[model samples]
Target: MELEAKGICFRYMSKTAPILNNVDFTLKEGDKLALVGPSGCGKSTLAKILAGYIRPSGGTVLLDGKPLPDQGYSPVQMIYQHPELAVNPRWKMSKIAHECWTPNDELLKDMGIEKEWMSRWPTELSGGELQRFCVVRALGPETRFLICDEITTMLDVITQAQLWQTILDIAEKNKLGMIVVTHNNYLADKVCDRVIKLTDINHI
Candidate 1:
């Protein structure tokens, strides 16, 4: 499978300067690409566009040469930087984690998710813990391309390493494509097969 964004352009409003301009990006099965750029350079915007979370102002995002399906779990899944914001505050961790599909015990254990944590609400878990749930949920069987938009930025070094290892293992096992968005060069080097600076593709 391949996720491609061709000649993409976007801006929040008509009056504002464009966040992205003629951006082109691609990720194929087993490809782990890091998207790096200075802050506010529209890296996250492009990630969202690629994951079908937001429509681009111009151009198209295609999965295997067709528009992403509007209904059902997207083949392209995105794990955001802020887990707290991604999940429903009103729901328990179990509900949130299994909202799409129930992950097996082995998968949860690999992600460092404890069974005890499942009974609590989102606020009850720490950032790292909440992020574990987000990662697991995004790794459902339907997910083909994973867009990790600064997904480990908020974690401690230990947690960061652990999370990345788990993600890499899952990707390798599933032959999943990944687009990692981050400003950390060391992390980009450690996690991605190739790193592309957003400015190199974003004409703006």
Candidate 2:
């Protein structure tokens, strides 16, 4: 794993609302880290920084003790709160899954999703199914780390629990590092090895 951020700073263009200031953290292999804070506290911003989606105004982000790439996404992938929004409307579920991994009908069935659903469009599937596919997509080739941004926010409690367990199991099996960003402390306790409160980070 080996992720770290030193003296990070970020601000939005809308206002001087400094989202992150001098944020510092480290995540090693098999680390299940949770970033928790109130909305607008910059938890998501920091997550973006970790994933190399956004650059910090100051400081550095490293992976395996080396600075992360400047352009293009990191090997790290993200699972968002809404899977439907993440998938393309025109592509069939099978296509989406294939883009992530070789088609394995057995795996789909084991995920409690029928193989027949593979031919269906994103809009044809239920929310949970869509999200399951979204997770699969992010777990595709080259993915070593996952930045889960409140991924279960759009699901029901039962679905959330099931998905969380599945994700944790997958991460452990694959030795994948994860940074889970959520405001829900309870969920954090259930999923993360250690939790950090974003509000505690200092700024310049």
Best by lDDT: 1
Best by TM-score: 1
Compared with the true structure, what per-residue lDDT tens digits does model 1 show for residues 86-142?
Answer: 999999998998999989999999898999999999999999899999999999988
Clash pairs (backbone) in predicted model 2: none
Estimate TM-scores for all models.
Answer: 0.98, 0.88
After superposition on all C-alphas, the RMSD of every candidate to the true structure, in Å, is: 0.7, 2.3
lDDT of each candidate versus the true structure: 0.93, 0.80
**Residue 34 displacement in candidate 1 (angstroms):** 0.5
Runs in model 1 lying further than 4 Å from the true structure: none
TM-score of 1: 0.98
Give the per-residue lDDT digits (tens) of candidate 2, residues 1-204.
Answer: 688888898887747877778888888778899988888778777888888888887788888878887655357788877788889899998888877567355545545677788889999998888888878777754667899998888778988887787778778877888999987888999898998878776553
Whole-model lDDT, candidate 2? 0.80
